[model samples]
Target: MLTIRPATSADAQVAYDIRREAVRHHCIGAYPAEQMLAWTAGTAEDGYASLMASHFYMGCIEGEPVATGMLDVNAREIGAIFVLPGYMQQGLGKQMLAFLEALARNLGLAQVNLDATLNAAAFYRQCGYVGEATALYHSPRGIDLACVPMTKVLV
Candidate 1:
């Protein structure tokens, strides 16, 4: 069974670890090694500690966190939606997205946006997002990642 809950500081590292696993394992073939390494380089405890103030959700299966996502309310964007490698293709990501969209609707957001990873662009489209041209995002670690900008209207 999957349970979704607001993430606290105590769950920071757990969420970070799941993000790391999702990147290192699932994103390997889609992204070059160097890019993946740069993307995941700062997924440490302190980084996630700063995320505690944001609207983040941790998805757990029987009390173990296996997925994580964040909603940027002010920006009306979805950020860092990731499911652990072992938990992929099981509808967890979709469920997390639905949960976040519900929250966005409650917040009166008319639309939401995201820069989808190259591998995940199709999935976002399947979820009703319309994609724009691919763009190069300069990661915080100073790496350029190709991403597709997408948006979905909530209203």
Candidate 2:
């Protein structure tokens, strides 16, 4: 069984590892190698530590953290929902998304939005997010990646 819990600075490496695996393995079909590499290069342990400290970032753990999700209440956005490549297609992503949405509802958010990578936009759509437009997102190193802006209203 998978359990969701608050992530800490200590889990930074786990989060970083999962994001790297997911981006490297699953996103190749949608993005070129250079862009993918740039996106993956954007985060590190310190980045995740600040994310955990500022937002509602959670981990999905069985024996270890195999998935992570971030919900920024101030932005009302769902950020960086990722599952380890080996753990894909196991419904972990859906569960984390539901948890984020529920948190948004409880926080009095009327809607939640995300900048979904081209590779992940379909998955977000499957979870009820409507794609608004395709846009360019800049990486930390200033590489532009194609992304879809998506939103889902809380009912």
Worst lDDT run of 10 residues, candidate 2, spans 42-51
Task: State the displacement of the C-alpha of residue 99, model 2, in Å, after optimal TM-score superposition.
Answer: 0.3
TM-score of each: 0.93, 0.91
Error of 2 at 123 (Å): 1.4
lDDT of 2 by residue, 1-155 (tens): 67888888777777887888988999888998877776777556535556766554655555588888988888899887888888899898898889889989998999999999988888888889999689987755567888998999999
Off by over 4 Å in 2: 42-46
lDDT of 1 by residue, 1-155 (tens): 78999999888888888888888987778888987887887655545667866999999999989999999999999987999998999999999999999999999999999999888998999999998699997765567899998999996
Model 1: residues with Cα > 4 Å off, grouped in runs: none
Q: lDDT scores for all predictions?
A: 0.88, 0.82
Question: Which candidate should be chosen as best, given TM-score against the real structure?
Answer: 1
Say which candidate scores most in lDDT: 1
Q: Cα lDDT for residue 9, model 1?
A: 85
